[model samples]
Target: MRATFMFRAGDVRVQNTPDPVLRYPTDAIVRVVRACICGSDLHPYHSLPETPGGTTMGHEFIGVVEEVGADVATVKKGDFVIAPFAVSDGTCEYCREGLHTSCEHGGFWNDTELGTGGGQAEAVRVPLADGTLVKVPGAVDESLYSGLLSLSDVYGTGWHAAVRAGVTAGDSVAVIGDGAVGLLAVLSAKQLGAEQIVLMGRHRVRTDLGREFGATEVVAERGEEGIARVRELTGGRGVRRVLEAVGHLPAYEQAVGIVRPGGVISRVGVPQYRDAEIGWPFFGKNTTLTGGPAPVRAYIEQLMPAVLDGTVQPGRVFDREIGLDDVPDGYRAMDERTALKVMVKP
Candidate 1:
């Protein structure tokens, strides 16, 4: 089998690797059918130091179950399944509370130390099989693969951001960043009945898709200028909910500036900085700061129906596709801002 690995910054390669096998009673081997590179993957691609064997890449994927351990009951051989980015014991207390990302015995994909392989490959060793994989009901059309794949990460993540921000009917919300997650946040906000959705991004192509997703306005500026534009759009009062989809410091600062008094700011983007502002500015406004890794496993079932029925098209974020061998090129396209999101067929 072949899988993607990052030898160092700007060096991603699809290399030959041994096939994965079930190592635990709760594990399953999934032959990846669809996978993609995530924006978060770019973090390591930008600054990871050289490694002897390189590190595995990718997290989001939907595949056909080729094998399952004796203890696995929810899914069996030949079942098409969705694997969340994180591995969790479904029976844990946190999972019962819809916070699978915080499960007592949970971890992420590509944890080589834990013997887990990357999704951008021919197959992956999915630990906590019954708890981590969701079977797609019945036969699925090939056209829906990308949409179903989005639920594994980006779509669920966007839903998490909106849910954490407490988006409600007739409320106004501002979403920062125009990445896949940010655009999906716009879609989620619309579904939650947000009356106004402001998408802040610099790219015209992505922002246009954001508009189609539900952004009532687009603010392409940054810093103070962007903050003022959002304020002006909301009648100089800022929005009640600010969904920060970009993990950078500037994006967070903009969220602080655009959140109205007594509002909430949900950050779903993986944080890239160490420290952030949490002083008088947020304190004086009584703003609530929330959001994290987005326990996407919890939302998969809730969001899958819409994708299956074609009610929503969150997969529109995927602007390009490549074969398993072209993963290196996929990473470069995403890193260079030439692709909104890249889908992989292994």
Candidate 2:
């Protein structure tokens, strides 16, 4: 098998790896059909410490089941499935409550301890196959592959931000960042019935797509100016919900600035900072802070219908495509802001 590995910052390579096999009763072997380089992958691409053995890269993928262990039942050979970024046992307490990310037996892909290799490969060993892989019913055209792939992470992640923020019909909302997740957050807000969706991003191409995704307003400014502009748009009261899609501290600060009193700020972006202010600004306004790793496995079923029916096209976020061997160049393109998202077909 050929898989992606990162040896250090700015280093991604495709190398031959041992073929995956069912290692546990709950495991499954999947032949990768499609995978993607997530925006979150860039964090490691920027500054991961050197690891001689290299860290496996990627988490989002959709593939076909080639083999399943003795205990696996929910899916079988030849079933097309989507693997969420996190692996979990579907029978766990947290998983039963739709919090699969907190499942007792769950872990993320590429975690060395779990040994579930990265999704950016020709095949992967899927831990907790019954829980982690959502079987796509019947045949699906390749046209919808990107949309189904989005369910594995970005779309689900953006949906989590809006859901945690409590977006509802007629509510006003603001989204921070213009990345794939941010644009999808706009889509999620719209689907949840938000009346005013303000997208804060500087990229013309992204914000334009955000508008198409239902952002009623686009605020390209940053810092105080950006905050003031969002506030002004909302009649100086700010928005009722602010979805902070960029994990940077500045994006957090912007969320604090544009949220109305008693509103919520949901952060889905992986935080890059160690600490942030939660004192007067949040406390005084009675603001609520929420959002964490999205249990996308819990959301795949709910979101898949729309994608299958063509009601929503979240896959538009994938503006570029690359083969398995070009993943290194894909990283560079994403890092250089040359591509919105890169779809990998192995």
Candidate 3:
């Protein structure tokens, strides 16, 4: 099998790797059908000093099961499933309480430990298969590829951010990034009944998709200018809910600063902080802050129906498509802000 690997910061390559095999009774091996490059992957791709060299890259994928362990009853050979980025045992205390991401047996598919290679490979080993894999309802189609692939990360994550922010009917919400996750946050907010959505992005293509996904306003400014514009749009009160999708310090600060005094700031960005700071102004504002690695498993079932029925098309965020060999180019394009999201066909 050929898998994508990040040998060092700013380096991504597709090279031959050994095929994945079932390592646990709850595991299943799947042939990768569709996979994607995520924005979070950029953190290490750009500046993580300790990012291990020669590690398989990628974490989002949709695929068909080629084999399953004896204990994996929910999925079997030939079933098309959505592999959530996190593998969790459904029976864990945390999983039972809806915190699947924190399950005692939960883990991520990475280069270390029980590595199943990367989603950007020809096949992947999915642990806790019964709990982490969701079968696509009915038939799969070309139009459904992106949506199915989204179930692995972005769509579920964006929905989690919206839910954590407490977006409600008639409330105004602001999304802090224009990537696939941010655009889907706009869609999720809309589905949650928000009356107004303000997308903070400068790209016309992304902003345009934001509107189509239910964003009522698009603010192209950044830093103080962006915050001022958001305040101006909200009658100086700022929005009630702020969704932080970019993990950088500036974006984090912007999310905290743009919300009203009693607003909620729900962040889904994988913070790349060595020594993160939250000043006095944040505490003085009395705003509620919440967010972390999204427990995507908890929301997959809730969001799947919408995707299957055409009520929401989170897949619209995919702006470009490339083959597995072009993944390095995809990363470069996204890093340069030349693409919103890249869907890779293996």
Candidate 4:
């Protein structure tokens, strides 16, 4: 099989690799149909150290079941499934509480001995299929691929951010970031009934999409200026809910600065910073901070119906599509900010 491998920073390739097989009774082999290059993948693509064993790429994927292990009764051969980025046993205590990302037996793709569940490959070994794989009930077509793929990560993560912020009907919210997840967060905010949603993003294309996704305003400013712009738009009251979708200290700082007293800052960005002085800013505002790796599995079922019925179209976040072989090019485009989101057809 041909799979994507990251040898080091700035080096990504699609080359021959061993095909995955059902290694455990709880595992299922999936023939990847649609996969995506997430914004967070840029973290390692630009900073990862050299490793003899190249890492497999991609975490968002939807595929057809080519084979299933003996104990995989939740799905069978020929079933199309949506596999979340994280692999987990469905029956874990944490999973029951809808925190699959923290499940005792959970792990992310490409971080395990089975060489991660390389979704960028032609096929992948999906563990805990019953818990991690959600069957796609909608028709399989190019039109639906983007929405289905979003269920695997970006959309779910954005949804988590909105939920954690407790976005309610008629609430004013500001989303920080114009990336795919951020754009999707804008869309999710609308679905949750936010009356005024402000999106902070610099890219014209992305901010334009953010408007289409229901963002009432787009602030192209940054840092203190950005917060001032948001405050101005909200009549100096600041927003009740602020979403920190950019995984950096500055983005977090802006989030803390703009949230009104007693508001919440829900962050779903893969936080990279180690420490911060949250005592003064966040606490002084009486803010409630929430969010982490989205338990996508928990929300897939909750959001699938909307995708199937066309109530929401978060799929608009993906702007480029390519084949598995063109994945390296996709990476370059995203790494250089030339594309919003890159989807791969294997």
Candidate 5:
């Protein structure tokens, strides 16, 4: 089967690769129904050395199981399922504690030796199938694809950020970033009962979606001006919770700066730097910081119902759609900010 691979930085192409098959007793071979590009993939696309040839890119997808190994009982052939970005064994200690992303037996699909294949491909090998795959209820439909696919990563991740930020009814929440994850953070805050949801972004399309997702205010400013605007909106005390959806230094600082003393800052963006400076401003604010890669498997079950019931339409984040052959263009469009999120159908 043909798969998308990163030959080097700035070089992503669709190339012929070995077809994926069941590799473990708990594995499942999935014919990908839908896949999409992710922001994290852009890191390697722009970084050197890390841009090794043959690296498959992508982590979000929903698919139909073509085959399942002997021990996989929860799912079977022909079932539509959402494959979380991180593959994990359900019985692991970490998974039992609701931290599937850190499961002892968990592995990131793109980084494993098997290279199970990315969502941007025609098919993918899903390991620990019974543990990592969530069966979509009832029949699948066009409208369900985007939302179901999001359960694999962004939606759950955004919800995790909101939860970590301690969002609650009547609390003012500021979401820093307008990407799919950030926009979802706005939705998550509203779902959690936040009275005021402020989205900080520059794009009109993304800001529009943020409002639909529940953002009551939109601040297109950045740096000191952005901080001033957030403060101004919160009556100068700052919001009670801030969601940092962009992992860069500026976004991090903005998140911290816009929250009131004793507030919380939940960061969900993939950090680009090894060491981000945290000075007196961060410490003196008495704010609590929490976040890391989301444990999507842990939240999928809890979030699936909302998607099914149409209470949350996370798929709205996908503004562009393409086929497997057009994945390179999908990456370019997202890299250039022409699309909020791109959905690739195989």
Candidate 6:
């Protein structure tokens, strides 16, 4: 099989790799059908600390089940399924609490002892099949692939940002950043019943898409001016809820600045700063801050109906598609912001 790998910073290669096979009774082998390059993959692609060996890239994927070990029960051969970025037991207390990302028995594919990188390959070995794989029902087609693929990561991530912030009908919400996740956050905020969804991003392509996704307004400014814009929009009250989709310190600071006192902020962006203050600025405001890696498995059931019914189109974020061998270009396009998000099909 062939898979994407990173030998060093700024270099992504597709190379022949050993095919995956069931290593545990609870595992399954999946033939990759569709996969995507996530924004987080750029973390390592940029400058992750030196590793003795190159690293495998990619986590978001949907595929057809090829073989399952004896213990695997939730899905079987021929089933079309999606796997969250993390592998989970699904029966753990954390999983039960809808926080499967922290599943006691699970870890990220690249970080776990198994060291298997995900869906970027022609095939993959998935452990904890019952807990990790969400089988799609009925007919499958290329039209639905990107939307279904989104349930594995970006869509669920945005949903987390909105839900964690307690976005409700009649509430005014602002999403910080306008990357794929940020745009999805705008969609999620709308679905969760926000009366006003404001997107803060400067990119014309992304902000325009954000408007399509239900952002009632787009704020292209940043820092103090950005805060004032939100305040002026809300009659000097700021927004009632804020979804922080950019992990950079400036983005977080913007989230803090634009959110009204006593409002909540949910952050889904992978934070890049070493020090971020929450208490001091939040002092006396009773601000509630929540969010982390979205437990995508936990969200699949809640989010799929929308995808299946076409009520929402999270996959619209995917602006470019490439064959598996061309995944390196996909990475380059996303890194340069030439593409909102890239889809790679195997």
lDDT of 4 by residue, 106-146 (tens): 78998765445578889999878788899876457768889
| Candidate models: Cα lDDT each | 0.94, 0.95, 0.88, 0.90, 0.89, 0.90
Model 5 / residue 338 / CA error / Å: 1.1
- Superposed model 2: Cα runs more than 4 Å off: none
- Write the number of the candidate with greater TM-score, choosing between 1 and 5: 1
For candidate 5, the lDDT comes to: 0.89
Task: Give one digit per residue, the lDDT tens place, for model 6 in 131-162.
Answer: 99999998787899999999989999999999
Which stretches of candidate 3 lie above 4 Å from their native place?
48-53, 274-279
Candidate 2 residue lDDT tens string, 257-319 = 999999999999999998898989889999999999999988999999999999999999999
lDDT of 1 by residue, 1-346 (tens): 9999999999999999989998998899999999999999999999899987999999999999999999999999999999998998888999999999998988889765468988999999999898999999999899999999999999999999999999999999999999999999999999999999999999999999999999999999999999999999989999999999989999999999999999999999999998999999999999999999999999999999999999999999999999999999999999999999999999
Query: Backbone clashes per model, in order?
Result: 0, 0, 0, 1, 0, 0
Best by lDDT: 2
State, as a TM-score between 0 and 1, how close model 2 is to the true structure. Answer: 0.99
For residue 72, model 3's alpha carbon misses the true position, in angstroms, by 1.0
TM-score of each: 0.99, 0.99, 0.96, 0.98, 0.97, 0.98
lDDT of 1 at 287: 96
How far is each candidate from the true structure, as Cα RMSD in Å? 0.7, 0.6, 1.5, 1.1, 1.3, 1.1
The better-scoring model by TM-score among 1 and 6 is 1
Which digits, one per residue and each the tens of the lDDT, describe model 3 over residues 21-80? 889898899999999999988987987454455778888999899999989899889988
Alpha carbon lDDT of residue 100, candidate 1? Answer: 93
